[model samples]
Target: MASGSIKKEANGTWMFVVDIKDETGKRKQKRRRGFKSRKEAQAELTKLLNDVNDGTYIEPVKTTLGEYMLTWLDSKHDNMSRLTIDSYRSYIKNHVAPSIGHVALSKLSPLDIQKLVTDLRSKKDHKGRSLSASTIQRIFNIVVTSLNNAKKMQLIKENVAKLIDKPKIKKKKIEVWDVDEIRVFLDGMYDNRHYICFHLALLTGMRQGEILGLSWKNIDYEKKLIHVTQTLSHDRKEINHGAKSHAGVRSISINEKDVAELKRHAHRIEEEKEKAGEELYEDRGLVVCTNIGRPVFADTIGKMFRKYYRKFNVTPIRFHDLRHTHASLLLKQGVHPKIVSERLGHSSVTITLDTYSHLLPNMQEEAASGLGNLIFSDPQKNEL
Candidate 1:
């Protein structure tokens, strides 16, 4: 049996004190304060007693949101990528922890989360600019995920974060280079040292990490195929085995011209190795590396890319925009979306269509015109 009592407090509020026994049969008093009315306190007491009677009671603890989030992050370290984990930690330490970190995890409310989202929208980073909608949305997602986990662990009766609306994010227009622009850039950069890196990005739509992680063993010279098997981490400190997703592990076919370029690049590597000597040179069998066989940093590549595009007087776009340019060009050429999706290592064709939906209107018009020409053209007239 369970027993409890509710009474008015000296501060003109209501409090409840429940008599309960621990797992070891030791008697204890569970006290909760700050209810607005006696009825409210009574209702809470009734619920607590019912929970205990049904063996569903969870002992209350004073764990703060800050403390619990750190614990949650630590638990996820093994399952998440280092880049992802670092991003989450940055959000927690910089935005989340400083604001509502002192609040009790059990006491966190939907209103609190909503206010947090509102504040984040107005908040500025160290650069003194307002947080981007995407960034706010990410932080909101982290809070929702953390609270959901808390509910699963029985630390909270319900996930309060879910009761609130998620932050709305505005989609940014995708930037890509046109065919003429690509040709101009490539022709100018053809003799450059890092030309092959830019060439592979535009040709195969391989990610920067995938390009940097490419090994000699993954390339099939006779078949003219490149197999994506691994990626370098963003920090350039670790080589993470496997692709970003299951679909990311795929083979991309290359033309004979591409094979020739790669072979030329391989010869360049051999010349450098010979100059450095076997004792001084470290051979990790990487397709793209520094003179001493060290992995080239992603930032270094981005800087070089920016420098070349500027020197070529081409309209500026990020290195990643090169991958986008490849997909855009292929889609514009009437290649099926499924093929584009597979080549880009997207998880699904739907993602490919959604990403390039802006291009669909033109494609639709072209298809209609092509259909009309096919059905209405006179074969006899054409032969005459």
Candidate 2:
């Protein structure tokens, strides 16, 4: 019989209600599942009814992944900056929908997802290499998140995507620059045109985007600090807003050296403006920007780092490692985890400890000391 939650007058057809609970405790009725067995269908219907009574049955609708993703993208109107959403749309269009756009909403299965991921894992792109595990994982996560939201929207009966086994992602060991390494790097940067960018990155744990987004107004050379509040993206596109975390918005301490470098750079900027004989750059008071005074792209900074590596015979690392190096150096110098968290703009102190705990000294001494004190200490209450 055709099956559904509501009754139909035709044979081989039925209507039934399902019960699914929302995030709240309230139970709701969702209708329809097409099963061939009458007894099985009856059980399913009864279970759904019970769930509705118990506040557990999630509704079922028939919207495909493509449909849900489109809605999700629309909902991100304000949460995401304009530039980011543009890239997100591009990625989805070029990499995602082309493969699975035909899959039915209700018929989507883990096997289908697993095969998609596995295939991507093996194939190379324009880079002439198989996609990195991290990239593949990100794409997979976006798809799963979109599909999960679909389930929540009652467009699908079950979130089978959750059941799929995900490939184990390895956390590559972080390569941080030691104090000597930082000194060497900065010494070399003094002669480079992008020295200001490299110097601040080495000193403060601010992200690449944050450093690039920096405005001169954000810096207090007299106070020897730089306030990091935002970041820039690729293409010098506007919409680099808000720090990665609330803590990321904190002021970073600068030294006399950084102040001097910025001073020298500022003078050069005015020289370039005079050469152009017009207000070619934005008057945003940016600390580091393009030659013409637009915001710097994150990838451009990364490429700059690569150029330095080729020039200096240094080990190749992305611009981001500068932030990691800053945190690791702080921890090595016996700075507290909370301070590191604040410096790196981690959302919480726990995040700091988790990331750097392995690099800290062993807890054996503290544990032994605690044991000794507890064993020998007298109880004040007992004495009383």
Candidate 3:
């Protein structure tokens, strides 16, 4: 039978000590202190004895939140990408570790997590601006995930992070350019060397990384399809040989005009290769590359895009906005959401719908008008 006793300490507090058998049948004393009264200590000791009898008692650990999180991150190295692991490490080292890393994992409470959220809201970056809602939410998610793992490992009785409310994230409005703006931008950038890069983004809804990672072999010229099989890391240091998600691995069909433009772009690359000579050109088979065939940095592309948009007097939009513009134009032209989702490599049509829900009202109005015309138009007019 499990047994425990409570004793009044000289410091005017109460303590409980219980003798129990561990999983290996070895006797050990579980001691807890800092109770305000003998009654309080007795109640806790009784619960401990019951837990020991039920085989639900967890051994107390002194592991701090910082230490456990570092161990957890190390465990994730083989399972996660280097970029993702780096991001998590930054959050732990820069934000989490500085704030509450010293707090013991066993003693972590919901209020502590809430305080972390509050501090993150008030914390400023190098630009003196507070952390964005999305970023704070991501950090909160990481904390919750780490605590959950601790609970699963039987290191903690509960996950305090789960008891607290998640950080609120306000969705930013999606910005896109209209068809006339697209035409104007294309007209002005036709002669630019990076024209094909932006064109593929707008035409295929391919991400900047996907476009930069594109190889000549991935394109089916006769079929007018571009297979998205790989992507470049944001820093341009690594070429990950797969899509961002399983659904991201898809084929996007291009128009005949786009195919012809791509062919012309390929011919230009061939000429550039000849001018650079065999030794000078490091042909990695990338569709878009520098004169020496090295991959262009993603940041450089963004800066160049920004410069051209300002020069052309078009409303400023980021490079990724080009993908949104592509999807928006297709949706406006009455393409099915499923088809758009497939082309954009979204995991599901629901995600596509949620992202483009703003366009639904206009689509509904058009549908209503088309329905009226179908029902009210004269038979003769229809025949003609």
Candidate 4:
């Protein structure tokens, strides 16, 4: 059974001590002082004894929020992706640490988190722009995840964040180009330097990094297939092997025309490599690169697209919408959504359907119309 005792401290304050056995069957004592009355000490002691009996007791700890968050991040290092780890570190270092690093982990409250969220929402960056709703939400999520882990570890009895409301996120409209718009854009790109990149993006739905990370080795000309095994990191300084989820590492079928275009692009790369000579040739073996054989940066590619878009006077669209454009065009052509999801490397078909649900009504109407025509039409009556 748990037991407690009250004693007068040398500092002339009442102290309470509760002794109990821990989960490991070892006896331990929790002591707290500075109460002015025996009644006050007894009240706290009673709470501790009840907690010990209920198996909900956690030993007092001096761990600060900053300390716990850093340790939590370190524990996640091996399981998380490099990009994710980096992002977490940035948020912790730049935001969480600066704001509430000194707050004791056990002492943190829902109001403290709410205040942090409010401050983050109002906080301006070096550019004098307020924090975006998404950024603030992400920070809140990180803290909540950290606190949740703490709760799971029995460091705290409750996750205060659960009591607060999550910031509302504004849904973004998915933008896509129609077939006619794509045709106009591509037709204006004849003999353009980055034609292969744009063409592969629209036709294959390959991401920018995947397109930039492509190598001759990833393609099988005879099989008319392309493999996505790696991607250029957003920073454009390193190749992230097995970059996305396992689903992202997939092989997509290409048309013969696309394969022919790829071969031409390969040949052009060879000529450029030769022109650069042995000394200047970086020999990275990437399918897309600069004149000097260096890996082409993603920003440079985006800027190139933007420049061409302005010059051609086509509808203004971000380069990423090309992937959306490809999916949209295929859906309009009556292609199955599962196939589109696989080609786009989405983790699930549900994501594909959700993203393109707007287009589904038309397809459903067509299906209904076709079924009605088949069921209601009478060839014999029509002949008569």
Which residue ranges in model 1 land beyond 4 Å of their true spot? 1-3, 19-28, 46-57, 368-384
Model 2 — TM-score against the truth? Answer: 0.78
lDDT of 3 at 364: 79
Sort all candidates by TM-score, best to worst: 3, 1, 4, 2
Cα lDDT, all candidates: 0.90, 0.73, 0.90, 0.87
Steric clash pairs (candidate 1): none
Q: After superposing candidate 4, which stretches have Cα over 4 Å from the reference? A: 5-16, 22-28, 32-47, 152-154, 359-361, 374-384
True lDDT of residue 211, candidate 3: 97
Q: What lDDT tens digits, residue by residue, belong to model 4 across residues 336-376?
A: 89999999999999999888878556877888999998899
lDDT of 1 by residue, 117-202 (tens): 88898898789999999899999899889888988999988888889888888777788988888899989988876788999999
Predicted candidate 3 versus true structure: per-residue lDDT over 1-384, tens digit per residue:
888888888999999888988778899888899999888898888887887788787887899998999999999987788899999999999889888888998889988898889889999999999999999999999999999899899999889998988888777788888888898999999988889999999999999999999999999988999999998888888888888889999999999999999998988889899999999999999988997788889998999999989998888998999999999888888898999999999999999999987855678788899999999999997788
RMSD of 2: 6.8
Q: What TM-score does prediction 3 earn?
A: 0.94
What's the distance in Å from true for residue 64, model 1? 1.1
Residues 56-167 of candidate 2: C-alpha lDDT, one tens digit per residue: 5444446666666767888887887777577667657766676665577777888778777877777788879877888777778778877777767767767776788766
Highest TM-score against the true fold, candidate: 3
